[model samples]
Target: MPSRTSRPTRRTALLCAAGLLALPRLQAAPAKKPLPPPPDVWPRPALVPGGVARLSLGPSATRPQAHSGELPLLVVGDAIEWTALVGIALAAPPGEAAITVAAPGEAARRVPYRIVAKKYQEQRLTVSPRTVDLSSEDQARYEREREHLAGVMATFSPAVPAQLHMQVPVPGRRSSSFGLRRIFNGQARNPHSGMDIAAATGTPVRAPLDGRVVDVGDYFFNGGTVWLDHGAGLLSMYCHLSAMDVKPGDQLRAGDAFCKVGATGRVTGPHLHWSVMLNRAMVDPALFIDA
Candidate 1:
């Protein structure tokens, strides 16, 4: 007996044909492109009224003859209630003023910052007689020290990156506040330029962020001092140290031990005087730290 020839059922044939027709159409569809990364959101930390933003200033802002050195960059914005980070750039002689923004039509704007340069007068003190006396020789010494410090401050590279996080150099209660109206011996003096951390002698002082030691010296007023450049016109100074563990050009990391607290300079007691300077203007360091 001849077996019945197998044949394709009409329903099965139609289904197969339809599937074959769909294959080409599915393959012809366009491929999907990838999505872009998200935009950066800045942390809105509360800033003191008239507080300056910490940022880097590039080498182009400084003298061209010197291929290397840091230029101090300070940020001063119009006094406003909301907190925002401002970027600043300085142009050489024939300086033109203009406001630039990251986006067009944005309410936030940058304005021309007028920085007035002032010459600081130096006073000398004699330890033996416990008198604040200025001798010709002492005056000369003070002038030399002042010049050296000014040079160091000038070398601050505006190219160095700003510190993203800040911590107290040592665990202590804050005493003398930064920018306080300070009077010494019945005479009004310049406002306090740095924050004073009241800690016992020998307390370890740490760096608040990664940076390079730009200057270190013992001065008549600052006592033992260390300045760290954390890029772009942002520099940190630690003074009145009993001991210094780092020197100029030494690289340091955030929270690294840099010195020990002391009352080395003209101070009441052992404490860490921490300062942040932008474009030579002494600004409050607390604005950058979380605590």
Candidate 2:
């Protein structure tokens, strides 16, 4: 009996094809960049508002989780020595508050802490009537943009941030206008949620730390805006930008130029409105900036 002619097996053919594909890929692949070093852990204060408080997770082999008033907090370090980054809201009442810390296979524990009252200054400014009172059409547009921005600010990515010590995005004098209750044209508005840096138009705005660009768009109030997610519910926003160098999904490293300062939105001059968000709450930018 004549034996059937030998044939190349499917598995053997697949191996040859895979080897051919890998050869070109290995030759053309670019060198991988080294990651930035982790940031130094800042000292956690006891009474926190514009600061962060640390909560001990105790001795355990498993990593722990934390929360402050229903808002999930940032937990860093290992099991043997874990600390919860409790971000106290600017409007958080100055009184007894508790943080819930839980570890795997253990009951959740509440760490009681107090928040001290911090008095913010008042600023009265009489801007143009159009800015204070938007027209019906502009108001509708502003509302729509507001909703869009709220979604951007609420982004929480799983990527853990490397450096927490952030550089000032733009080189200028950081105005003491943060958290100011402003009277715009005799109409009181929400307190200022960001730090205003006085800078000339076209000044290059750099990324304070490594992060991914989550959103970029021109808003009614924010004008040309860019939102960066530094991971673990830590977000940063740059408003009134003249131009953007990156878009959503773009990853940037510390000191990378990402935007330019401008008077694009509702602003009195060319400057940058930088806001830092922790656990979706807009906190003082001074909390993260080193210089």
Best by TM-score: 2
Name model 1 segments beyond 4 Å from true: 1-50, 53-133, 158-163
lDDT, model 1: 0.62
* Residue-wise C-alpha lDDT for candidate 2, range 1-291, written one tens digit per residue: 634433456667888999898785446668789998875455324355565666777767866878776667777777578877776677788888888988888888888877888787888876668887899998999999888877886787766677677888988887645688888888889888889999999999999989999999998878899999988888899999999989799999899999999999788888999988878767777766553
- Model 2 weakest lDDT span, ten residues long: 39-48
Candidate 2 residue spans exceeding 4 A from truth:
1-40, 43-48
Quote the positional error of residue 107 for candidate 2 in Å: 1.2
Tell me how many clashing residue pairs each candidate has: 14, 0
Each model's Cα RMSD: 13.8, 20.8
Residue by residue across 88-152, what tens digits does model 1's lDDT show?
22111223223333222334334343333222233322243321456777678778989999887
**Model 2 C-alpha lDDT versus the unseen true structure:** 0.81
TM-score of every prediction relative to native:
0.61, 0.81
